[model samples]
Target: MAGMPSAHSSGDSRAPGTERDGGTWVVIPLFNESSVIAGVIEGLLEVVEHVVCVDDGSTDGSAEIAEAAGARVVRHPYNLGQGAALQTGIGYAREQPGAEFIVTFDADGQHRVVDALAMVALAREEDAAIVFGSRFLDDRTRPGLLKKAVLKTAVWVTNLTTGLTLTDAHNGLRVIRIDAARAVNLKQDRMAHATEIVLQLGRTGLPYREFPVEVLYTEYSRAKGQSLLNSINILVDLVIN
Candidate 1:
């Protein structure tokens, strides 16, 4: 709804049947989200034709659930960090027959399907190489105070390092065109890859836009919120790599 020039009802269960239907593939880096993985994939399938879940050694049967939910499942032998899982998913998605765009979505159910669809539409309409979903673009997403502070810190670090002023850098909802997706080479193997992704995509000199998105902070998401220690570790990872 943010970048959409025309009115859109995102609640429509029918796939928009647009250029994005088969051309857009969602890459979700999943690790031990068995309880919500099925619903996440199911919701994605309602909007897009391709959904790829990279199971990062999830022992909780997440891979099976995702496959059963109609997603193409790629398994990791062990618990690689989020960055590795993303690299796997993106690589897998890019190889698909008709993949024109690769969307990086969170497996925690915080990311909304409607937002992803809108971002994809925005990319096609503007001929953008990348469309980043930013919660800070609008007041729709309300993270907790501490969470907000932590995210702001991440944004600061990302902007400072990447030379691109993005409102939300750690947001896991991003629509990257195949050309831009090809530019992604994440090696941090953890949360620090978020910053690295922005830097790499920026180096491509491609057209990009930030779309407003609402991240639903349910109890489940809040329970797995980013802590100060984790933030510090991500910073350390960035510094080291």
Candidate 2:
């Protein structure tokens, strides 16, 4: 909700519902992902018309490449964590006309558009406020043993703390109705935001479901993704903050 006012208060003529039924915006929070963001946006545009990429102060030309790939790029003056970038993109999507739904996607190219489309379709069919993707529910995704163990532990901890029984608490792929989108206020500004989202939903008591989805962990994602130390830090941050 922090960035929602700027979209209108700035006196922009393009109000929310500018696209009517086509108001589904895929929000991708990007870092120094110039190497992969173009292809990511290209694939997302194939399914959804409005793709908002928030560049979290990437030194690389990520914003330019994303804009060239047909994404509306929002830039941060400095490096904010993934959580802050997501909040910015989500707020922008909220102000779009006919923006009925919003999807949180990764710029690492690990997420599949087919999965996102499935979540979007599910959101419409069930009238669910939120639909989250779970890699553990599907057999197609093969995470490394260590990664699997860490994430499984994370899911358990999140469920225990948030009091929600979600199989995949931290999976990035998620779809939410406009109401749920407006209600999600993230403050962690880092990997901790994943947990924060669940916590917020628990407090709001929004309807949520988990759908099985596939994740392709190539060398790039595995190398650039969260590490064991980062995971530990996330737990500490969640507890302290």
Candidate 3:
């Protein structure tokens, strides 16, 4: 698909072409998450319509899976970083025919559709431009000590840089209204773009909220997710940038 697009409406890519009455669009930045991408797409479809997966040059036939499972697939020619994929997805999504809001979701099944819907509803009720899913807002998410420490450190750095006070900086579940989304221009082509997203969105001076969302740290999610080295890389990104 050349165009079109979240409530954490994003997922890792792989699905079929599914359609629905459009209001919100979910953008999933996909890589090699072949096994779980279809499930994520289907789950999101139950709540909202118009799921689009940006396949970040995955080698495991992820784009095909996503298209087959009911999601429009945007394929990268080669392996690009998640930031680039997200930028592309959001950019593409915001241009869709009936788009009103965008959700950035993860493809590994760590994010919940209920949390995404709640965040979207919050945005509508509060007239907020941005709604961020924060695992640290309550006791629902229990990240390991080391992971929490590192993520908390990253939050501090993100707040310092973006001047936006937030409890969780890297939680992938986020709701961005169309105007706020149009203002986003992600330069960080890596996961570091998560912070870049905060910085750019904060500059918009639009209303934002943080809603508590659970992050399921399943064994599979953990294995496919950030490693110690990846965490440190994220930290260094904040420090150096």
Candidate 4:
């Protein structure tokens, strides 16, 4: 919080028309994540004032669960992928009157809630436009050998293409300044949009930082989607697009 203005305590009193400060809204893009969205929203509510959940055409009850958990819900007509879902949620966040920062989180239960708060603090203290969660910062939490090889190749290619040195390029947890986010025009609609985001950030020369984050590989995440083959698909998308 070095560069940011001091935040008022949650119980501090202020004028009726004064703006409230501290943590900003969190945007979680989910697709058929009924089993975990509630917990994600609840965990975030403890630290943030607003939580927006974008339901990317999930036939399941993910939207209902998010709404029930006290999150603002936005529903897409079809499954538009994580990038589009995030874009939709970001649009909603920009419209909020007092939202100063935007934090993008995953709905698959991969990102930890505590790390998200840490990312926010880093964003404020460092005055970064974007703050990403880097799982590779700690060697103990690294992925399997094959997975690591694929990600390393992907990171190398991303660096070559975007000219940005990033240790982990696929992490979903990120915090961004509202102004910097407003300047970005994310057009990718599928999984490849993850890489697209970084490329855009690099092209724009936005200030960004990477922070250590924990990874949770769960049975439900494995069952839901995101196979090893998806890496190939992402590369194909990157090449063709």
Candidate 5:
């Protein structure tokens, strides 16, 4: 774990079960998502008490929009990829006063706001270090044929490499305990970081679970860069690295 600290080591100062509220913070990583980030932030604010948005060197005014929408904004000077953005956001969450749990959400309007409650509740109830949102658990939300094929391949490869049996391995909407996140380091900067996170979690033997999540594949998200090819690139990155 290059980016994450050791789990058994006690680097984080927050004591377990010390916080009274057990508050959760939502972290959204955005890159040139000026059109949709505002709405995502507003929707998340309705449910979560704290929201942090990491602007990954977006040329567009994403940081301004996120700040105006009431999310604490962190900006990367250059495009460091989603993994770096997520790490930055998690670091911010760790610095917050009462951040017991952290949730990663997409700014491209794919994840639903209501799902956060279930993720948080499940983490608390099960004491799971990581709770991933699975779209394939329910067949109704399966993506297109090509996309589905890519996801299935990803699931297989992830299982082979990481030994974690996940129904939806590449889902962005995930809730994780702050301590667990701080423990598992993520070094990959590109899209492959998603797989890297899961792999690291498995290696550390962290407890995890998955729950059904709604997936809304809008034309905007599809057009903005989340294509089936990105999955291939992610795999390539994993292999090459």
Candidate 6:
């Protein structure tokens, strides 16, 4: 694999010969998700054999668990935000031989492999560069009233500012074409990266689409997910930065 950009301060190692045996490479930016990393990797492996878990300075041994589950683990020396983690993973995946597609999935186990595969198919069918998964398109996994309202407002603000009409702007589940993934650059290091991606995609004029997907909000994710204030912060970040 080619050396990662200087932005990756440390922890960019690949398993010997693992990069050559690739198909659909799923890039999962992992934080301290030790409780769920194993299961998440296992579930992802069921659909796609090549799964890259970028462990973003996880103190809870998330890298070990992911590696044990048959995933190619890329460790970060310290805690970078999810956006940075994602960029690291994507860069690593791009270096792999026979890297066909890239999928950005959540480490919290909220995203589904079925939905990801569907998005991949749709990206190929529509000839789109990127395909975003929209929870608002389906009623299977519903957010709470306040959470729904805040996220909806986020979509509105993002569309108004970036001129990209999307139903769910902050959804993490997305399938990006390998060629298009090379052009995708994320600047925002935090929650705001979601909006940054949309804006960047728009500016680059990449063919993109939204697909209906389920986001299972379990009690754990609800407790660990973004708060109301975080939504406002993301909006502010988009406006100023």
Task: Please identify which of the two predictions, 3 or 4, would achieve the higher lDDT against the true structure.
Answer: 3
- Local accuracy of candidate 3 as per-residue lDDT tens digits, 110-197: 9999899899889989999999999999999999998899889889989999999999988889999999999999988888999999
TM-score of each: 0.91, 0.90, 0.90, 0.87, 0.87, 0.88
Compared with the true structure, what per-residue lDDT tens digits does model 4 show for residues 1-241?
A: 3124423222323344634334487889989888888888877776666788999999988999888887788899889888899889988876666667888898988788889888888888998989988888887565778878877877888778888888887778888888777765667777887888788777767798999998787777657646778988888887885
Q: Which has the greatest lDDT?
A: 3
The candidate, 3 or 6, that scores higher on lDDT is 3
Whole-structure CA lDDT of model 2 = 0.84
lDDT of each: 0.86, 0.84, 0.87, 0.79, 0.80, 0.82
Model 5, TM vs. native? 0.87
Whichever of 1 and 2 has more TM-score, that candidate is 1
lDDT (tens digit, per residue) of candidate 1 on 9-94:
22333554543366788999999999999899888887677788899999989999888887888899999899999999999877
Ranking by lDDT: 3, 1, 2, 6, 5, 4
- Clash-forming residue pairs, model 1: none
Off by over 4 Å in 3: 1-21, 238-241
List model 5 lDDT by residue over 80-147, tens digit each: 99999988888777766656888999989999887877888898899898898999988758588888
* Candidate 4: segments with Cα more than 4 A from true spot: 1-23
Per-residue lDDT for 164-231 in model 2, tens only? 89888678899988888888889989999999988886777878788999998989998998988899
Compared with the true structure, the alpha-carbon lDDT of candidate 3 equals 0.87
Q: How does model 4 fare in lDDT?
A: 0.79
Determine which window of 10 residues in candidate 5 has minimal summed lDDT: 1-10
Clashing pairs in 2: 16-96, 16-97, 17-96, 17-97, 17-98, 18-97
Kindly report which residue stretches of model 2 are placed more than 4 angstroms away from their true locations once superposed: 1-21
Clash pairs, model 4 backbone: none
